[model samples]
Target: MTRLILPLLAAAMLALPASAQQAPTTPALNLQQNMLLRCSAAFALGQRLQQAGAPEAAGWPPLAAGGREFFVRSSAQLMDEAQLSREQIVTLLTRASQDLAREGQLARVMPVCLQVAGIR
Candidate 1:
């Protein structure tokens, strides 16, 4: 998965559209959404670290536990604040992640990714 992340990042960067750097079409995420996004990235990056057998990841069992908590709260927020069913939320997340991955394909995002994960 760690190996895949590098190639995925490269391919995603190359596939970015010229307009991806423009402002978003939708409203900003609410507070819950903000937490969800951070936790989601942390969880994903943490998992990638673990999969690569990083020694520090052993300290992150609590991270997985925290992910479950976030998932629960985020799940509830999906229905209440977002008025989205779980399946719809899943679709939206998949699409949004894909979009982010694509925007990440843009050169503008590479330096940030490299700084964060040495993936460039």
Candidate 2:
């Protein structure tokens, strides 16, 4: 997933495959779908953390409430770009986040979550 997303999201370094014919802002359905899927997963984690009342870490930069909103709004764009319904988007996000949580992968992915949430 990072292989695909890093290319697309890494500060204008977009070198999309033929399938990703659309512009970076709007990837085609097959345009490295995992990029948005994984990002949405990270965003889902952010929402969960917010709902759980997790405080800002003492050392890390403070996480603003708007970060979650950014992810939520971005999810809509993801769905629209891929022509997916809300339920489909929700399912993808839920499954990815759940799998990561079940496998105790949060520690590995929190940095990614923070990045996707635009924390830095």
Candidate 3:
């Protein structure tokens, strides 16, 4: 399970930028920003799960790392693709952090994370 999930996580990270680049303009899904937000939530949730000693936490480190990298890379892509300034990215991230914090536990956020990463 660990082996399988790790590869899926890595592949999701790699695929994110390409998928964002190819996303149609004016689509309902804001893929780039949504990915960043979901990954941020996932990172936070992973930390909490690890602290609680959940068995599923075994994959948290890698998922969190990949999510972080994906967040950084995707935010850059958002800058170029959406013409958003660095200030805007920071603001958006801050908002995402706050919103996710209010959104409760790992169970609530995990599905969004998986969806954003295109893992499910």
The numbered model that scores best in TM-score is: 2
Whose lDDT is higher: candidate 1's or candidate 2's? 2
Give the TM-score ranking, best first. 2, 3, 1
Q: What are the lDDT figures for the candidates, one per model?
A: 0.46, 0.52, 0.55
TM-score for each candidate, following the candidate numbering = 0.43, 0.54, 0.51
- Clashing residue pairs in candidate 1 are 12-105, 13-105
User: Which has the better lDDT: candidate 1, or candidate 3?
Assistant: 3
lDDT by residue (4-103, candidate 1, tens digit) is 4334544554455545423224335686565454444444455555676877555445334444355456647655776665444444444444544443
Give the distance in Å from residue 15's predicted Cα in candidate 3 to where it truly belongs: 33
Which 10-residue window in model 3 sums to the lowest lDDT?
1-10
lDDT of 2 by residue, 1-120 (tens): 222322234222233353332322333456446655765565555455544566622333434454446556667777777877554554455556667666447556667656756676
Model 3, residue 51: what's the lDDT? 53
Q: Comparing 1 and 2 by TM-score, which wins?
A: 2
| Candidate 1 overall lDDT versus native | 0.46
The TM-score between candidate 1 and the true structure equals 0.43
